[model samples]
Target: MKVRDFMIKDVLTVNQNAPLSEVLQLFVAKRINGAPVVDADGKLTGMVSDGDILRYINPTRQTVYDMFSYVFVSPPEELAEALAYKVETPAKKIMKKNVQSVSPEQDLEEALGILAKHHFKKLPVVNEKKEVVGVISRGDLLKQIAGRLNELNAKTVSR
Candidate 1:
């Protein structure tokens, strides 16, 4: 099977310059975990995932001084300020720049190899111009496999 066979054509994307807050809202509203980050020309520049957002919003860690045996904690106000700044930051700041994507004409196994190697849930399907045309996910591949299995089983039973 090819990626285009099961790829989702209606891909949802986010602009690189969009605020992290807006990306978070889009994630919630769309009930999606991540999206492709595109430039003004709709070129695939990066990918932003919920994991990236969570890491961005994570509060500053406490520091410990071994020699002085002193522990320094980040104040609530400082944490709040950091969060405020992070929310206003653009998605590009937190997005993974080196994105692994597949082409629509690529074989399913090739996409699966990329996904497995990267431990990614989904991959953006891009054209020759690196413009995102669709998206393929592990779930999509699984569904296709299941459908094929069912068809095979039906054929065997009929025989």
Candidate 2:
């Protein structure tokens, strides 16, 4: 099967100019961990995930390296205070600009390779115009495999 065969056609997408809060709300409402960011013409531009938002809003603590060991220190309260403004910031400011995508016609094995190699949970499927046509997730692939297995078992039992 190809990516287009099992990909989710009703994909959730976000606009580049959408606010971070709006993106978070969408994630909660749709119960998705990530979404592809699209342009006004519905062209895929970037991707934003819950992990990305978390990294931005709650930055990791600073690590100070000593001669013998590393000392981890918490971020200054001021830094946390500063990040509060990010909620209203545009999604483009925090979205991952280097997005990896696959064509709808691409083979499922090819998509699987990319996902496994990159440790990605989902991949955006694009058309020739570079517009997002659908999205395929690890769950989708698993479901397809399960269905095929069931079919094979049924066929064997009928023989």
Candidate 3:
């Protein structure tokens, strides 16, 4: 099987200029962990994930000396304040640019290799023009494997 055979043709994408809050809302509404960032022409530029959004909420590091010298250490509330400040920022600021992509015609083994090597959950399938046509996830491959296994079991039962 090839990537095109199992990939989702309709992908939910976000524009670079979209506000981070909108992006977060979309993720919640769609129940998706990430989205492909696309340009005005609908070309894949980057991707943003829930992990990237959560990074904004991490407390800024301070030197150990500063931690001891300060009258009060930064509290968890400070992290929330910092994240609130970034909620309206554009997607361009947080999207991952060095994305790993696959061609639609590529074999499933190549897709599996890419996913395994990078620990990626999904890969964007592109065309000759590098335009994203679909996306394939690890779950899709697993489902295909399960179907084949069931078929083999049926054949064995018949024999």
Candidate 4:
């Protein structure tokens, strides 16, 4: 099967300049974990996930040493400051630019290999112009496999 066969056609995307807070709200309202970031021309530029947002909003750690004793902690004020700054930042700042994507004509096994190697939850399906056409998640592939297996089983039983 091809990636186009099982990919989700109704893809959700965000603009590169979109505020991080807006993206986060979209994730919650849409109940989506991630989305591809697009350019003004509607071309895929990067990807953003809830994990990325969390990591960005997380405070940096600091280490202190006093006569051979060391202590590490993240200050509450620093975390609060980061949260404030991050909310106003643009999505492009935190989005993953090195996106792993598949072509619509690519084989399902190849897409699966990329997903497995990268440990990605979803892979964007892009065209030659680098525009996102669809998205394929592991669940989608599993569903297709299960449906195919059931069809084969039914055929075998009848014969």
Candidate 5:
């Protein structure tokens, strides 16, 4: 099977200039873990995921010293809190640009290989012109497999 057979054509995308808060809300409202970020011409630019949002909301420790300092020092804690709050300022600032994309004509195994290698939940499906037309997720692949199994079972019962 090909990616086009299972990919979702009606993909939900967000503009690069969209506010981070709005983007976060979209994720929640759509019940999606991530979305492809497109340009004004609807060209794929980057991707933003729930992991990115979590990283922004949750401050990371720079080092053991920084962790200790923050724990012992009140100012560092305040600074960390302030920075986490600032993370909701914009989408362009937090979106990952080095995205891995797939074409609709690609085989399902190829798409699975890419997703496995990169540990991605979904891949943006781009056309020959490099414009994103859809997205394929792991769940989509599983659904396809289940459908095939059901068909096989029905055929066996009929025989």
Candidate 6:
């Protein structure tokens, strides 16, 4: 099967210039873990995931080294503080650039390979113009495979 056969056509995306707070809201509201980042013209520029947001909001640790064996440590910044500081940051600042993507015409094998090799949960399906046409998640592939397996099992039972 090709990507277009099972890929989700109603893809949710975020603008590159959008703030992290808005991105977070979108993720939560849509119940999605990630989305493709688009430029002003709606072309795919990068990708962002919930993990990326968590990493960005992680607080920095403070440590100081005093003489030979002396050391001082300060409490890490609060999570809320870190979050407040980065909430207004632009999506382009944290989104992963040069993301691997697939075309709608590509075979499922190609999509599977890319997803496994890169440890990606989802991939953006793009058109010739590099516009995001759809998205394929690991769940989509697994669901298709499960259905096919059930069909084969039923055939064997009938025989």
> What lDDT does each candidate get?
0.90, 0.88, 0.84, 0.91, 0.84, 0.93
- Give RMSD (Å) of candidate 3 vs. truth: 3.2
Model 1: per-residue Cα lDDT over 1-159, one tens digit each: 788998999999999999988999999999999899999999999999999998888877655445567666654446677787788899999999999998999998899899899899879999999999999888877898899999999999999
lDDT of 5 by residue, 1-159 (tens): 898998999999988888777897899999999989888888998999999877766654453345645654333344457555774576777789999999999998899999999989989999988788999988887898899999999999999
- The digit string of per-residue lDDT tens for model 6 on 1-159 reads 888997999999999999999999999999999999999888999999999999999898986757778877777799888887899999999999979999999998999999999999999999999999999999878998899999999999999
> Per-residue lDDT for 3-44 in model 4, tens only?
899999999999999999899999999999999999998899
Models 1 onward score TM values of 0.88, 0.85, 0.85, 0.86, 0.83, 0.89
- The TM-score-based order of candidates, best leading, equals 6, 1, 4, 2, 3, 5
Higher-TM-score candidate of 4 and 5? 4
What is the C-alpha lDDT profile of model 2 across 1-159, one tens digit per residue? 788898999999999999988999999988999989999989999989899898888744555656557666665445557467778888888889988899988898999999899988889999999899999899888998899999999999999
How much is 157 displaced in model 3, in angstroms?
Answer: 2.0
Candidate 5: deviation at residue 67, Å? 17
Once fitted onto the true fold, the runs of candidate 5 whose alpha carbons sit more than 4 angstroms away are: 60-88
RMSD of each candidate?
2.8, 4.4, 3.2, 3.4, 3.9, 2.8
**Among all windows of ten consecutive residues in candidate 5, which has the lowest summed lDDT?**
71-80
lDDT of 3: 0.84
lDDT, candidate 1, residue 36?
A: 95
Poorest lDDT segment (10 consecutive residues) of candidate 6: 63-72
Highest TM-score scorer:
6
In angstroms, what RMSD does candidate 4 have relative to the true structure? 3.4
**Rank order (by lDDT, best first):** 6, 4, 1, 2, 5, 3
- In candidate 1, how many Å is residue 54 off? 0.4
Judge candidate 5 at residue 100 and give its lDDT.
93
Candidate 1, lDDT over the whole model: 0.90
lDDT of 2: 0.88
